[model samples]
Target chain A: MTDKDFTFTIDGASVTAQPGQTIMEAADAAGIYIPRLCDHEGLRHQGSCRVCTVKAAGRSVAACTQPAAPGLVVESETPHIQAMRKSLVEMLFHEGNHICPVCEASGNCELQAMAYRLGMVEPTKLPYLEPTRPVDASHPGIALDTNRCISCGRCIRASEDVDHKGVFGYCGRGIHRRITVNGEDLAHTDAAVSDHAISGGVCPVGCIIVKRVGFRLPIGARAFDRQIIGEAIEEKRR
Target chain B: MTAPRKARVATVSLAGCFGCHMALLDIDLRLVELLKHVEFDRSPLNDLKHFTQRCDIGIIEGGCCNEENVHVLQDFRRNCDVLIALGQCAITGGLPAMRNAIMHSDDPLRECLEEAYVLSPYVENATHVIPNDPALPLLLDKVYPCSAVVKIDHQIPGCAPSGDIIYETLVQLLAGKFEGFDPHIVHFD
Candidate 1:
């Protein structure tokens, strides 16, 4: 191992990482699953959703953005950190009209899976925003329903960075902030079903959906139903 | 030692589709076993309209969409020792809460009524008059989860939580062993 590769402890487990690698990247390499949303593999880390918040060096930080340091002690899976993550996930649920039962992304949704993993039975602590976001069903093969959008900007990043289409963008501020297409509707934009943003499993929720392919996987057979979120990452250790 | 008194259980459906009630029945033959521990007090299962006595447990299947639903839920809270919100409707207002998004308008209830009864081509209202009968229960400004109206001791979140979940919850609650549901079995859909 190079001199630049140093050791860090995540939840008391020793992990090795290169100098420039973020905590999330290093943790993944060590098969330590740091719960996160909006921080997809190969995509630029946004750290918008703080589901991966952890205590590093006695301070709370988003693991996805925080660079790993030698001898750094990171606390994850602790009650306080998990509680914070649960609250963040709950707030995301409250902020959006995420009707999981009717959502196309029901069982396959990362947000829903995270909620399940975090033991958030319901988002009862916060009032539902119930924002009347627009639904763009103009595209024959794709649909954009902003009601379920968590403002993670994954679609925005995937479209711009990967597809080179720049099909998605953001508008407004704070609670009013929402994802917007290039034009009036999704069809007006150059978004395609074949685009990496649509087909690449970028969206954590049902905001962006492949129309007609919904419910293709039966209830108990769907992604999260079969396995918990981050289980695959944790399985990497074996 | 005397045998423990069977828990007096009551159930009600307010602004829900009664699918939860159907799911409760979907427990199939296990219900016969469930009956061995709990006795129905004021439930549709036995067509009991009013509580004969204070109930040990109450299971509510929907959110409050109207004044009457709130009244019924409040009555349930008063008459039962423990209250459980039994479905997505009771927990998060579910499908009916879809109307809550339209509450941005000045008269959202009226707008919703007009769209449904007066404007929609699917319905044939001869005079295009919105229903305003005094006998009809007044719709609330917005649908509210059960916790917003009355204290909910516990919740089972699903469109209709599977029969197994309902059965397990009921059995555990009856045995006083319900810590919480296993996360794997607790699904939103």
Candidate 2:
């Protein structure tokens, strides 16, 4: 470990993690994987998906949000965590207007991988209430689908705070809600498409869908395949 | 009966359209069945009667619009036993909520007037950018979902809601059966 006396446990196995690190950051440092959707290395802690949630100090909280304390006990992948993540996957399934066949990201999607990871048989908890929504194929390279969004706000916050390419945002009150693509069209046609790299990078969900390149990868082969991200960054300390 | 104990509930909004409210009204016929067990108090529908009965299940729709909506939403948290975000507006901030970016523009009444309504001269004389009605509840600056405002117990999302869900929720509310998502759902995704 890079820092002095930085110690923690994952699944009852004690390990020395970097000092003042998050439980997620510590897990990443040790090459132990935990599924997550709303966390990125340089970006802020979203912890929205709740898939990364762990049992820390005898309670459940987002591993990404819970900062590590010395001798902290963390259960990275317990059956409870698995069940909670599976329920979350079911919620995503029932929520947005996600139609994989028509979606470009069908072959290479994070939600699909999560479903596979969880061995999701069906959404038995909540019934799928598919709301009718229009696709925002308004631009040349990007597509906005409000139906598929879990409202993680990683995209909106990334747009407003990080990229400054604030082309999109969430608006309206409850029930009458949506992720508006700029008060108008967000995908570039005759519009300023903002910085594509920055915009695409910030989205945790595939809400701000890029027209090409992103969705071309083979199934179960995206960057977040199995806690593929965040680990590398935390490992830098080691 | 001795004075009834209070039921703890809250209401919140996320990013979605408030069509959840229209959906909540889908239980209008079933409301007869519901009120037998629990009380329906506090809502936009309570214009004439202000805060009369304490709500057991706080039903909310729409996401947090701005700072004021956040503050007002706490009203539900204060009085209810369990909070239920009643529609898509409560869960994901439905269609109207998608306007978080400057893309959709900030004016909500204008959008409703332009898109959803067949406006006439008699309906409060609304123009392109009509002023907030002093007699009516004010509009928030932006839109949001329910969970953003306060802790939510149950969330029912759709453009509106189903009569069946309200019936089920009422039964559960009366039985004091709370915690977690509702079973007997039709289709989720």
Best prediction by TM-score: 1
Error (Å) of candidate 1 at residue A171 is 2.0
Model 1 bad stretches (over 4 Å): A1-3, B102-107
lDDT of 1 by residue, B71-167 (tens): 9999999999989999999999998888887635666677788899998889888989998899999999899999898888888877888898898
Question: Against the true structure, what is model 1's DockQ?
Answer: 0.52
TM-score, B chain alone, candidates in order:
0.94, 0.63
Model 1 docking tier (incorrect/acceptable/medium/high): medium
The TM-scores, one per candidate, come to 0.95, 0.49
lDDT of 1: 0.89
Lowest lDDT 10-residue stretch of candidate 1 chain B: B101-110
Q: For residues A144-238, could you state the per-residue lDDT of candidate 2 as single tens digits?
A: 76666766666656666566666556677665556666655664423333553234565555566766666566634545433433345546545
Q: Which candidate number would show the highest DockQ if scored against the true structure?
A: 1
Counting clashing residue pairs in each candidate, in order, gives 0, 86
When summed lDDT is taken over every stretch of 10 residues in candidate 2 chain A, the lowest stretch is A189-198
Predicted structure 1, TM vs. truth: 0.95
